[model samples]
Target chain A: DVKVTQSSRYLVKRTGEKVFLECVQDMDHENMFWYRQDPGLGLRLIYFSYDVKMKEKGDIPEGYSVSREKKERFSLILESASTNQTSMYLCASSYGELREQYFGPGTRLTVT
Target chain B: AQSVTQLDSQVPVFEEAPVELRCNYSSSVSVYLFWYVQYPNQGLQLLLKYLSGSTLVKGINGFEAEFNKSQTSFHLRKPSVHISDTAEYFCAVRPGSNMLTFGGGTRLMVKP
Candidate 1:
């Protein structure tokens, strides 16, 4: 089974604080994705990496960035956290174009 | 552009009753369909996918979905549901090699 793990299960931060969410996948999948899930909007993609040091902006990428220093690790960074950024963050990985993504336990972030 | 739509925002049903979650998509290119379930406060888990071959795909925990190309829909179904089945379900579509576009999601509530 593919295993994806996140650094934190829950987090709280003040406005304007910078936040980092880490994700690691056991399998050497080439694709990694970050998404923020809201009440009515569902999971909206933030950023994705297809290779180490390569990233692409997804539908909703404002105020967020990503890093893939290693193949197994992907990180999401919020330059300046705000109350609007408070939501569930999910990380997922898959091989190439395969849609069978393996997801890590989400990180519930709260910004006050 | 590819997009996914989940018609029902929430569905409440009694335990051991049949349930169906409707999903629709629009894409100019061929697309892959997937159904994912997210337990409370957890990440999404792949319930099933339709890439090719069979139109009716059976998934874990006695859940199944059929792909209807003419209607451009992939609706998930289960013969009977339990309390454990209560969760948020998301329908996603991947057009070609692009990133997946997810639906708003359907929250299933199973009552005793």
Candidate 2:
């Protein structure tokens, strides 16, 4: 089984604060994704990386950005966190398109 | 664009009883279907996936789902549920592409 690790399990931040969420996958998958999970919204993609130094914006990428300087690591960045951004963030990786995606443990962010 | 719909927002079943969670999806092209489980305060875990070839797919925790293409549905089922099975279940559909579109999710409560 592939193991994906997130840097933090819980995070707290004040409004307008910059926050960073990190993820690492040991599977050496080619595709990485970042999503925000909410009560009714399920999981909405924020950004995704198909390869190192490559990224694409998902449906809700307004306040989120991503960085992929390394193959095993992918990071999500919040330029200015807001109360609305307080949710669980998930990271997933897959070896190829439409393959089974392995997810990280997730980070629960509380923006006050 | 792909979309998934989970019919029941919450389902309550007694321990050792059969349970079913309904899921429907819409996509123009071929898509992969998946069910994910999220435990309390934990990240989402992949329960099962339907890629191709077979209509019935088995997953972890003795869960199974059948892909009904004509009905546009992929419902999850389990003969007997345990107390530990109480959690949030999410239905997701990927349009043969990398990104996945998820349903609103259904919470399953197995009581003793």
Candidate 3:
């Protein structure tokens, strides 16, 4: 089975604190994505990386940034966390030709 | 850009009851559709996908969805649902682009 792993399962941060959520995939997939899930709104893409060091903004990327230094790792960064940024974050990876994506265990972030 | 709409916000049904989750997509061009399920505190899992070929697509957990191009809808149906079927279902579309746009999810609550 393809496995995607997130560094943290739950996190709590104070306002203005810097936060990082890490994701790693073992399938050597070329595409990786970051999303935040909220009630009723489903999952909104925050950012995605098609290749190393390359990123594109998703529907909601205002207070978030991402890093893809290597093919196996993708990281989500909150420059300065706010209470509104509290949400469940998910990471996914997919092969270049496949339409299906494998996801990691989500990180429930609570920024107080 | 591609977008998806899932009409039902929450559907509560009894165990062993048939269920249908509706989805529709709008885009200027062609697109691919997918259904994903997310359990509480877990990541999203690919329930099914429609890339090409036949319209009816069967997926894991006895769930299936049919792609109706004329109607621009892909509705998920299950003959019977169990308590384990309780989860949030998301409809997504990829419009000849790398990014996948997801709909606001529909939460399925199966009662005993």
Estimated TM-score per prediction?
A: 0.97, 0.96, 0.97
Predicted complex 2: DockQ:
0.80
The clash tally of candidate 2 reads 0
Q: What is the lDDT of candidate 2?
A: 0.93
**lDDT (tens digit, per residue) of candidate 3 on A1-112:** 9999999999999999999999999998999999998887878899999899999999899999999999999999999999999999999999884558899999999999
Q: What tens digits encode model 1's per-residue C-alpha lDDT throughout A10-108?
A: 999999999999999999999999998988678899999999999999999999989999999999999999999999999999997874889999999
Error of 2 at B2 (Å): 1.6
Predicted candidate 2 versus true structure: per-residue lDDT over B57-111, tens digit per residue: 9999999999999999999999999999999999999886658999999999999
TM-score of candidate 1 restricted to chain B?
Answer: 0.98
Question: Once superposed on the true structure, which residue ranges of model 3 sit more than 4 Å away at CA?
Answer: none
Compose the digit string of candidate 2's lDDT tens values, residues A1-112. 7899999999999999999999999988999999999887799999999999999999999988999999999999999999999999999998978677888889999999
Clashes of 1: 0
Task: Tell me each candidate's RMSD, in Å, in order.
Answer: 1.0, 1.1, 1.1
- Sorting all predicted structures by lDDT, with the top scorer first, yields 1, 3, 2
How many residue pairs clash per model?
Answer: 0, 0, 0
Give the better candidate number (1 or 2) by DockQ.
2
Alpha carbon deviation, residue B107, candidate 3 (Å): 0.8
